[model samples]
Target: MGRNVKSRIESESQKNNLSLIIIILLALQVILSGVVLLRIVNLEKLIGGTEASEPVPVYVEGVSEGDNPALGPEEAPITIIAFSDFQCPYCASANQLIKEIMQEYPNQIRYVHRDFPLKEIHPDAFNAALAARCAGEQGQYWEMHDALFSNQEDLSIEKLNKQAEILNLEMDQFNNCLTTRKYENKILIDLQAGKEYGVNGTPTIFVNGYHVNGADREAIINIIKDVL
Candidate 1:
């Protein structure tokens, strides 16, 4: 009888142990599944499956269209004033888009590029802006502007000089203008104007006085469509 009782107790204990092991395994599976699910959601957010959220367009008053590098007719129906940094990748992308838009609209839009180099982050940006302006003195502002954006990864003084040569600009004059920092005050004014217009980032564009922040392609197009 004692043997029988011992056997029964051993069986019950074994069963209990098995049940606990099973519960632990289930709990582990649940935790792992939750972690995987969380990772998937985070990945989705990072990859950006949807279109970027657009900011509400506000008519920013006193936004200056100062004597900046511009394209298209001065009296076009839509004037796009862009505050940009030459070293900013987003600005480069936006520059291409703006160029395309210019081609698309042809005579309907005036596109102006204003300097807003983020000096702290992009050490070479201020100088790059100077280089473009120097090239402008030789009647190749847009050419140098395109070159700078194309070679944003390398905007050293040496590279700027090389680009000037490529554009056949008078090297002495271009270098002198850059060395003198001829457009320093003008760039500073643009930076100040950008700050006043609430431009805390690169490629901040104002279309006919409407503020469209960031390199938002759709927002830019939609705004232009509305204006036209």
Candidate 2:
């Protein structure tokens, strides 16, 4: 009878042990599943950030008529949209390259300039952009555009006034436009438009809607050729 009772107790102990093991396994599985789910969520966030940073091709839209400073034929097969800051040295470097490209493919390429001044790093760039827009009002946008890039070191209001004089713009009208922030809303629109197109840095060039982040002359020529 004692042996029988001992066997029954042992059997119950084994059952209890089995139940504990099963519980442990289930708990472990739940923990592992939670970990995997967390990893997947984190990975998704990482992918989202990468995609946001990548440049995507976009059609020209939202820009008003005569709002953008442009060169080349209106019906050119290729269009280059440039997001640039006046005070950025890289943008200054790219200016001559862009001009050369336009000269090379004068009829085939239409280049548009959009303001994307990084005011955090370049405090004078925003004012320079404003000055350029004010000059645009006088039908001398391209001339002021040239002067701004040529004398990038002197981007002060005084220098911009002098540039307006050189471009033969009426000082009374230009100064009033500048002082009164006549095109402040327009410039802000340009800056926001550039940001939406993933223009994180200066001189972000797009040829026929294709993103060109670097100043690779050969690559730019090839893109232009492909569109042509």
Candidate 3:
């Protein structure tokens, strides 16, 4: 009778041990799942990066070009031609700073925007520029430009359309403009110009028509000061 009782107790203890093992396994699984989920969330945010509403760099002959358009009088003093990419992070920052510079100089400084979409790295750069040109067709270039740079992330047709809508552009005109690639040649022309000027990377700038190879804000300011 005593042997039977001891054997029963041992069986119960084994059952208890099995239960504890199962519980531990389940807890470990839950912990692993939580860690994986958190990591995935962080990875996604890191990958998405940023977006754009409008991009200034022009694609000339498939090369990025400065959008200085027409040069001012040789005696116009301070001229800043900023070559930028719609998808470049540094260019984006530079552009924001450029706005302040523009404001500071106001009438005295002339700042031109050049387009050099590094589509290889920035897949959406071309699309963003395309959207800007579409907006320009409806006389909303600057409006779209501000919107693109402001939104800088989430650069998609839907977002571009929203920007156009906000600027009160004719959707049909904008859509048609984008579809027909109305400004494709214009962008290509800008790219060719960049080639002529030996612009390999962006945000290569030209201050007073001189290439500011490494275009940092201070460099630009100093050049402007010299020209001024």
All candidates in order of TM-score, best leading? 1, 2, 3
Who wins the TM-score comparison? Answer: 1
Better of 2 and 3 by lDDT: 2
The most accurate candidate by lDDT is 1
- Candidate 2, residue 185: the lDDT equals 86
Cα error of candidate 1 at position 65, Å: 1.0
Global lDDT of each model?
0.91, 0.83, 0.72
Per-residue error at 166 for model 3, in Å? 1.5
**Per-residue C-alpha lDDT of model 3 across residues 22-65, encoded as one tens digit per residue:** 99999999999999999999887776654422233232333222
Worst 10 residues of 3 by lDDT: 52-61
Residue-level lDDT of model 1, residues 1-228, one tens digit each, is 999999999999999999999999999999999999999999888767554545688899988799798989988999889999999999999999888988988899999999999999999999999999999998999999999999999999999999999999898899899999998999998998889989998989988898886767787788889877
TM-score of each prediction: 0.76, 0.70, 0.65
- Positional deviation of residue 78's Cα in model 2 after best superposition, in angstroms: 0.6
Model 2 agreement with the true structure over 89-151: per-residue lDDT tens digits: 888778778889989876887878888889899999989998998998989887888788889
Of 1 and 2, which scores higher on lDDT? 1
On a 0 to 1 TM-score scale, where does candidate 3 land against the true structure?
0.65
